[model samples]
Every structure is written in C-alpha cells, then in structure tokens.
Target: MITLLIIAAALVGIIFGVAAILPNDGYGHRPVPRSHVDSYPTHNPFL
Candidate 1:
C-alpha cells in the first residue's frame, strides 16, 4: 500500500511539473526554445 501511494504521488508530481512549464495561449505570448536562448545578445542594455 505504501509503494502504491508513493507511485501515485510521483505521478501527480510529474503532471504538475509538466503543467508548470507548458505555455499558455494568448496575445503577446512567445515561446522561446532552449536552443535559441544563446542566440540572444547578452550585452543589450534593455535586458
């Protein structure tokens, strides 16, 4: 029973983790992939 409970809790955590990072659909919403972060200028004063 304890093992089953642990597995259930882990599954819930995984679901929440995925939801936390997923992007929402709306105006002005831009999703930048990890591969593109390095392409941005680091010396920009606005950053």
Candidate 2:
C-alpha cells in the first residue's frame, strides 16, 4: 500500500514536470484545424 502511494506520487510529479516543459502557444492549448471540424457531419435534419 505504501509502495503504491509512492508510485502514484512519482507519476503525478512526472506528469506535472512534462506539462511544465511543454510550449505555450499563448492560447494555452493547440487549436483544432478547420478541416478536422468540417469532416464531421452536422446534426440538423431540417436543413
């Protein structure tokens, strides 16, 4: 049980470290491309 807690703590630390090292695009996240969004069909049946 103690080992499990330690492993979980280590994983959380690593995740935060990686996240901190990632580039910030000012928006805080990468934007989805327009082609990806347009590929999905719209749900409006009345149109």
Candidate 3:
C-alpha cells in the first residue's frame, strides 16, 4: 500500500511538471518567438 502511494505521488508530480512546461510553445499570449530575438543582428540595423 505504501509503495502504491509513492507511485501515485510520483505520477501526480510528473503530470504537474509536464502540464506546467507544455504551455510555453506560443500558448497564444507570449510575445515574439525567442529564437528570432536571439538571432537578431548584433548592431542596430537602422544605425
């Protein structure tokens, strides 16, 4: 019984972790993609 409880707790924790991290892919609110910002020109293109 104790083993079963431990397994259940682990499963719940994993679920919560996955849920928290799964929304980062443009979940309809985050501004510009980070990839683009990181690759942007070093010097201001306008200058």
Candidate 4:
C-alpha cells in the first residue's frame, strides 16, 4: 500500500541521516596528543 511505501522511505532516510552525522573513527585508530604545553602554566601544581 501507499502507507507501507511511505514508512519504508522514512526508515531509509533516518538510517542515512544518522550515518552521516556519526563520526567515522576506524579500527585501531590512535588519538594524537597535543604537541606543545600551555605557554603560561597554571600556578596550581595539581592542574
């Protein structure tokens, strides 16, 4: 029926929209660390 077709199309759109928004971090990817520290260090040693 026309109703069934509309439901199917809506589901497909939701799936594609979610996929586009999510991050694509792949397997075994390591995050890079900051290259340099803050120029003016905080007075609090705990920081």
State each model's C-alpha RMSD to the native: 12.2, 13.6, 14.7, 16.9
lDDT of 4 by residue, 1-47 (tens): 99999888777666544533445212233222341113323222222
lDDT of 1 by residue, 1-47 (tens): 99999888777666544533556212234435543223433322212
Screening candidate 4 with a backbone cut-off below 3 angstroms (N, C-alpha, C), the clashing residue pairs are none
Give the Cα lDDT of each candidate. 0.46, 0.46, 0.46, 0.42
Tens digit per residue, CA lDDT, model 3, 1-47? 99999888777666544533555423444334443223333322221
Q: For candidate 2, lDDT tens digit of each residue in 1-47?
A: 99999888777666544543455322466424432222324322121
Models 1 onward score TM values of 0.49, 0.50, 0.48, 0.49
Candidate 1 overall lDDT versus native: 0.46
Q: Give the TM-score (vs. native) of candidate 3.
A: 0.48
RMSD of 2: 13.6
Question: Clashes per prediction?
Answer: 0, 0, 0, 0
Residue pairs with clashing backbones, model 2 = none
How well does model 3 score by local distance difference test? 0.46
Q: Among all windows of ten consecutive residues in candidate 4, which has the lowest summed lDDT?
A: 35-44
